[model samples]
Target chain A: MKKLINDPKNVVDESVAGFGLAHPDIVTVSADPLFVARAQGASQGKVGIVSGGGSGHEPLHAGFVGFGMLSAAVPGPVFTSPTPDPIVAATLASDGGAGVLHIVKNYTGDVLNFETAADLADAEGVRVVSVIVDDDVAVKDSLYTAGRRGVAGTVVVEKVAGAAAERGDDLDAVAAIATRANANTRSMGVALTSGTVPHAGEPSFVLPEDEIEIGIGIHGEPGRERIKLEPADGIVDRLLAPILEDLPFASGDKVLLFVNGMGGTPLVEQYIVYRHAAEVLAEKGIEVARSLVGSFVTSLEMQGVSLTVTRLDDELTELWDAPVETAALRWGR
Target chain B: MKKLINDPKNVVDESVAGFGLAHPDIVTVSADPLFVARAQGASQGKVGIVSGGGSGHEPLHAGFVGFGMLSAAVPGPVFTSPTPDPIVAATLASDGGAGVLHIVKNYTGDVLNFETAADLADAEGVRVVSVIVDDDVAVKDSLYTAGRRGVAGTVVVEKVAGAAAERGDDLDAVAAIATRANANTRSMGVALTSGTVPHAGEPSFVLPEDEIEIGIGIHGEPGRERIKLEPADGIVDRLLAPILEDLPFASGDKVLLFVNGMGGTPLVEQYIVYRHAAEVLAEKGIEVARSLVGSFVTSLEMQGVSLTVTRLDDELTELWDAPVETAALRWGR
Candidate 1:
């Protein structure tokens, strides 16, 4: 695999250290290979929030750690979930005298690892709650299948739950918001080009210049469909039709609209996608209460975009508008 | 150009529309192509904020809009600044009652376009204050040249200024804070592989698998140097030594460290880089007040990372912690 570095074996360790050095004030590296930020008195009854997955997607688990976000973000290998030990360590490090909430995206490996960590944390008497995010609408809930995969909507879940925790809510409240947010949201993505994983050292898959993959997952996983490239308007219809159909969003219902770039897609193109998406929404008589069109969550250098929709009520809207300060997403009261 | 889209022309429009549909609460598209957000009130006062840049980097110019950030984000094509008409339109759409502040990232194309837009706004009797962000350390500053390019540090400037604006700080105060943040910060990036610009339909350039480009601009522009791949620790030194040398930060001075991913590197890798970077900073005796590691601002899907450091004081810290509620970031009391 073609990558920049002195040695492949040390890639994970070095990257974590670099993260601490870069954002020293908001976060600090612990004795364990995880990140912890100085909380606003974690011991003062604030529920700790911890989240982690494979490392390739930057700013997801780690960058989102701060005052109103995750307290600890564990780093695993590229595209690999953090092992049980680091999860346990991170949970321990972020224990603010209150219980800890583990926000695990619904990948099989991530769910399993986080589960193990939660079990271990429970054994240690550290109250731990696990919330699995399964927002992707592309995956069919087959009898044998685990159901839809989690995609970009996890950012929203983290922010809402993080805000709840920051407000000194109990683990139950935070996890409830997280679960509701995950349930209320749906996402679908398409890849115009396959990304090259650094370690794999090759394109995830070779695509002819004109081809595209629809319903893509964040880790360069296979999408639900593949079709020839089309206009922005047509593409938006294809991607959104399923989401709108599945969710049954009604006219005048407020929603959070997210047009996320899959690593490589440019903002200019993202805007174009947004324009067409708005047109589609207008046709449906749906009201867009808030919108985020950019690459908040991403895959590794894959040239494509994902569309996520979250029907928002007053509570979700308030939580969505609540202040947050993380390395990636920041704003609020 | 290996992209995943079915058609090149439809990419941007599709992305933007999809984003609007996803987050209907805090954002929407205006009547104008460039003006983003619902027609309803969003900004705090008449002193509306409008910013734009060539597209590609996510959550920078556009994602930072709503309650506490931007009123409108005028986006141009990938790696190209928005034209004058769009800026003027966005300015008008965002104007509440006070006027407008144009936060311009210091690139030749952006400067020129924003200048033209400011003149147009002036002609319309709308107050327009423009702040140029030039924080890259790659280029040496001398009377003989244009000085440093604006890199990722522009985000800090925008956020601080946006917060100031939200607090009803006059355009002048907001502009001044933005100017100071720009002056206090510096950033430099390196590229491990060239990115593919979708419309251009080609790799920005070819880099041998083992080599990396240092001091890169966000547009995939050539950096100051290209060298063989080195250890993450060594790369940290190579990148940070120059920044530290240039700033000559005093001992015991606090700093905000940012290890930003250039689109493609995974979180695992970013954390590893952080680990090495932290070691380097500790050796320097700098009290790191904050550290951010993630893909905050990105190049289209380049496999690389950039380091941004901002010397912080109490005021900056307070401002950094201020709440915001945009599509990308949200936080506050």
Candidate 2:
């Protein structure tokens, strides 16, 4: 594998150390248990927000740790779930007088670990609440998940919930906001190529040169179908059909449209996807109120794209527009 | 090539259209001559900053168009230099009452075309000053360039120069700042795989599975040497040696360290590189006063990275910290 790494075993630690050094003003790294926390620490009276998952999909939990976003992020090994120890440690570190909220993706491993962490934190006198995100509409169950797997919609949940917590919302309020955002969000992905994990030294799956995988999961889970490669618009139609119907997003409903790159795709292509998706939404009389296009959440060097749509009300829109300063996502500050 | 595009001939236009749609609040797209201009147009009295080049290396010229950055951007076909017509159009559109400055990379075609555009704009009564950025320390000259090819250091030039223009500096003053930044900057890149141009339908160059090209140019040009892929630190040592000696960067020199991914590499690996590069600098006693890391400048999904270091004074540091908003780079704002 042609990856710029020293040892596969040290990828997460070294990368985390580099992240801490690059943004010392924004985040602090704890080496003992490997959790990234806000450099300024948790606010005295504001509810703390924390989330985490596998290491390969970067800029997700760790890169989102900063003002107006996550308070702490716990990362596991590449494509593997973190144990409850680090999650509990992160929860404790992020907790303030207002308690803490854990935004967990709906994968079986992630859900179980976060649950155990919440219980452990509660035992230590910290009020903890957990909200599970299951916004991927591609499959009902996959390799690492029981129900629908959480995907790019986790970004929506983190941003909105983090905004609420930053504005001094209580633990319950932040959890409710996160849960609501997860419920209203839908995401679907298509992979043009499989990503090889550093340790595995091989691609997770073999895809022919002329075929594409539709409804693929972030962890290279088998998708709904694999078909011959088609035009960009045709692929968009297939991915968007399920997402729109799953949310049943109706005409006149305003929403935030996000087109994300699956690591290896360029920004130009992501914008092309965004352009056509926006055009399709306009044609269906659905209002594209807000738009985000880039590679925020990615599967280590996979070449593909994911589309996410989040139904937004006035409150949600305002929260989305609020100032945020993170290593990956930043705006309105 | 398996690319996410429609007709290869329509790639630039369609992507530009998508970019305009994605960031309508920040930029305005013109189709006639094809240029991306700031949404609010040129400030009434502030000197305008403009930059452009071939497409594919995205988020470079077009993505940098917004407040406190390029006033206008012109993009050509993929991996091809733009003609003088669009360059002139963008120049005229960005000209305020004060004047306009053109930041051109050192590639031969880009230099000649931008010079012609500047002359045309001068004839139109807009005072224009042009600055060429040639910060790659890779080689004295190579394909597509008469001098050292401009690489990721163009970002340093545009950002510092954009801030100068935004603060109401005259055209000459902005050009001087840009020239200074370019002079102090040095960059080197390494490529593990060649990037495929959409229209080319093949990779730019072929390489065996176990070797990498060090000092590789952004356009897949031949580099200094080809050797078996080594560990990340060893590769970084080789890339940083020439950069340090080219400027003869001395101990105690305060600088800004920028680690830019060349498209296909994952963020984790980029950070791993940054970790080692920063350690090397620290060992040399060069103070890393400011840091900018990410895939700001890219080579169309090539698996590689470029490292850039800019000597910073108090003025440049303040300018770098200035508030700016663009599709790709945004911070203090």
Candidate 3:
């Protein structure tokens, strides 16, 4: 694997170290039970927002730590769930006496660990809630799969929930917002190339040239099927169709559209896909109230893109428009 | 060959359309002589900032247009220089009564076209100045090269110049800051794999799985040498060494370090390199006043990373820290 890592085993630790130094203005890290917290101290009367998962999908959890985003993010190795230790530590550290909420993607390992951490934190006098994001519609009624795996919608969940928390909402209210955002979103992706997991020193999976795997999972998991390659317009239609139907985003509905590159796709390509996706949505009379197009959530050097749509009401739209300051996504001080 | 594009010939126009829609809060576009301008309109008395170049290196000129960055950006086809007409158009569209400044990278086509446009704009009663950035130290007096090519340092020039203009600096003052930023900065890059231009429909150049090309230019231009793949630490040292000596970044000097991905590199890998670069600088007693690590300037999905270091004085540091909001970069606004 042509990865920029000194040692495959040290990828997560080294990357976290690098991230802490690069964004000192945004985060502070405490190792041992590793977690990254906002540089500013947690507010005493506000709810604490915490999210964590495997490492590779960068600017996802760690890069989202700042005001108006996650208060703390616990990171494990690439494609491996963080054990309960860091999640519990993150919960306690991020707690502002209001409580802590864990935003967990619905991967089997991640769900198990975060659930255990929530239980452990609750037992220790820190009230905790977990919002599981299972927005990927690509799994599509497969009896062999674990429902749907969470994908880019975790970003929207963290963003909207963090905004609500920043606005001094109670823990319950923040948790409610997170749940609503998660429920309203759906995502699907296709991988032109597989991600090379650092430890494996090989791609998580491989596909032949001239074909792509549709309904791919974020961890480089096998998708529902391998399909012949198509143009940007066709690819968007494939990803967007399931998303639109799953969310049932109807005419005149306001929404936020996220076109995310899976690591290796360039911004130009992402924009190209966005062009077709936006046109498709416009044709359906769905107004994209807010749009994000980039590698906000990415597999490690995987060539692919995912489409995420979040149906929005005024409450969600206003919260989405609220100011956020993070290393990756920043606006409106 | 695997890219999210409808047609190779239409990539630029389609991506521009997508960009305009995605960032409507920050930019507005004019169809003819195509240019992206600040959506909120330019301040009447401030210097107008404009930059343009090939399309592939995204978030460069186009993504920088907004309140505290470029007043306008004109983009050409992928890896090809924009002609004089659009540059002239952007210069005119961005001008308030103050004047317009063109930030040109040191590619022959870009410099020639921008110079021609400047002359035309001057003839049309719009005062114009061009600041050429040639910060890459990788060329190293090679006869095969046209001296050093511009790279990531262009981002620094636009940001600092934009801040100066936002502070109501006159055209000369803003141009001077941009010029100084360019002069004080140095960059070098290493590409693990070549980028495929859309129209070309093939890889620009190929490196075997076990090798990397050091000092490669943004458009897949030949570099100083092709070497065996090295660890991230070794790679950072190679790229950062030339940048440090060229700027002669001193023991006690304050500098801003930018670790840029050439499109395809993930944020995690960029951070991994940033970690090593930061450590190397600290060992030399240089204090990194600011750090920007991401794919700010990228070749279309090139698997590479570039290191840029700029010696920062109080003026430059404050200007760098100033609040600015753009589609790609934002802070303190």
Candidate 4:
């Protein structure tokens, strides 16, 4: 378990510095201790979007900063939430006078940190709206506990809401879009191999070579059950059945099919999953409007796949079709 | 060595079918021998860009099909070239009556198959042009061979060409743009662990726990040299020095820096590489206009990373910024 790094402690900060240098026009390293928009001059009147959590998921928070996505992304330790100061710094840097929107994934640490940051921003007379993306279908949604944990579907929410903000939509409108994106998207993942958190140089969990854990968390949390590795099509069906049942997608409705890799899976295997995913959808007569596949959101180097289906309407489709220039996504003129 | 696949032979076709079901609006699939396209119809007078290689690079040729990128992708067997007929079918499916442009990555099998299809299309009086992407800096420019081979830089070429074609550029114009994008972009890769090609259920190569290889091909081809795993900053410096020297990037020029994972490398590590890449560029006063860090074009489950830099001009930047709606790249309005 060797890594190519300077110091384990400086990994995130050095990475942010590199990101700033690579896209200086679009971003700048704020002495505020994180990367902020270069156009401190232009953040006014626009509802600033700020999101951050962990450094392992590249292009999630920092790579997402640009025109239509996030205004700033505060860097945290790998798979850990950023401290309150950086979040507050990002909010202040992106406060466009209109307000700021904090999109936090429903991880406990992320939620708590973002909530505190929101409170601090309010104390400073900056209007702050927070939307939590809790789209993972793997966790049970019981009133006794928090709703399903947020997973990769957070990317969908960021894109749609970011578009709403770029279109001059008000803070309320942007928040509404974020809410809708979250409501419409559902995701579930399974880990074939547990990831070794670089600092923790061992497997996250151990499974027999023939077994895979279903309904696993992003950081290789235990899944619902262990099953023999099946064909890709069957694996896709297992993941999607719960998702479709939970969301209750109707016939003739459209969806944005996302086949996301959990770190160690190759594109070849992912395509196999996507293939079966399409078969399942067609059998149900669902119309897929657009499709996305790759490691947009990852859990270190966990060997698995997550399927996120975002039901699309005319508006969502249009927003999804909007052009964005970022390190992770780029399209539309 | 276990995989989530029923049979290796049916992987590509089944995956194509699943993709069609998942993206019906953007693509339509035929059953007899699989081929796909956007149901909205190809853009009129726009050069229909098509590309394909082995089926292992998921979300690549197939996942990239949509509004602005590839119109059709002819998928081959795993790590093998797609048959000639499928290439012809993909061309026919995407030819919008304007003409068609083929974005072929430089490989002997791919070049020959695409050339054959272009000749067949020419016989049918269809205007067809092919641009071979040979941007891998790992290969030396030798008269004895066709110079350096094309690798990850093909993605940048497809993206830029897709933007040009989507803007209603003619075949010649799109082909020219693709050629320039290919020329301006250079990539070099190195693997830590060998990728297990699906059909071959084992590691592609073996390295001890401490050693790493530099200037390796995405496929399991041998690299320029093997060395002990070093600090990320030094690793990136070693990799980028050859690319920068070969391409001769000048001071103050804008470049797109991509630190792509070879499946098994974690983003945390990729970020370390990105951080070092930025510092090295800063030391030379070279500026990166945009940077992408993720697993875009991967080589199975290889524990490696590839660095690609494309010199950007205003036109190239605009084209790069153009909005594309695909299974892989979706952003921009």
Which candidate achieves the best TM-score against the true structure? 2
Instruction: Give chain A TM for each model in order.
Output: 0.94, 0.99, 0.97, 0.94
Q: For candidate 2, what is the recovered fraction of reference interface contacts? A: 0.65
Enumerate the chain B TM-scores of all models.
0.94, 0.99, 0.98, 0.94
The candidate, 1 or 4, that scores higher on DockQ is: 4
Cα error, residue B258 of model 1, in Å, equals: 3.8
**lDDT of residue B231 for candidate 3:** 93
lDDT of each: 0.75, 0.91, 0.90, 0.80
Model 3 chain A: which ten-residue window has the lowest total lDDT? Answer: A139-148
Question: Which runs in model 3 stand beyond 4 Å of their true positions?
Answer: A140-145, B140-145
Candidates 2 and 4 compared by TM-score, better number? 2
Cα shift from native, residue B298, model 2 (Å) = 1.1
User: How would you encode candidate 3's per-residue C-alpha lDDT over B10-81 as one tens digit per residue?
Assistant: 999999999999989899988777889999877798999999998999988899999888999999888788
Report how far off residue B109 is in candidate 2 (Å).
0.5
- The DockQ score of candidate 1 comes to 0.39
| A1-333 per-residue lDDT for model 1 (tens digits) | 545444665565566566555665567776465555544435357899899887666657777888787888887877787789988988887787789999988877888989999999989989999998888887764221277777889888998898888878898998999999998898899888776666677887876777788787777777777887776567878889989888777788778888887766655467667767777777788877777766667676677889998999888888887776666666643
Across residues A246-299, which tens digit of lDDT does each residue of candidate 4 receive? 888889989999988777787667767888787678789998778887777887
Better-scoring candidate (TM-score), 1 or 2 = 2
TM per candidate comes to 0.79, 0.99, 0.98, 0.87
Indicate the worst ten consecutive residues by lDDT in candidate 3 chain B.
Answer: B140-149
State residue A297's C-alpha deviation in candidate 4, in Å.
2.3
CA shift of A233, model 3, Å: 0.4
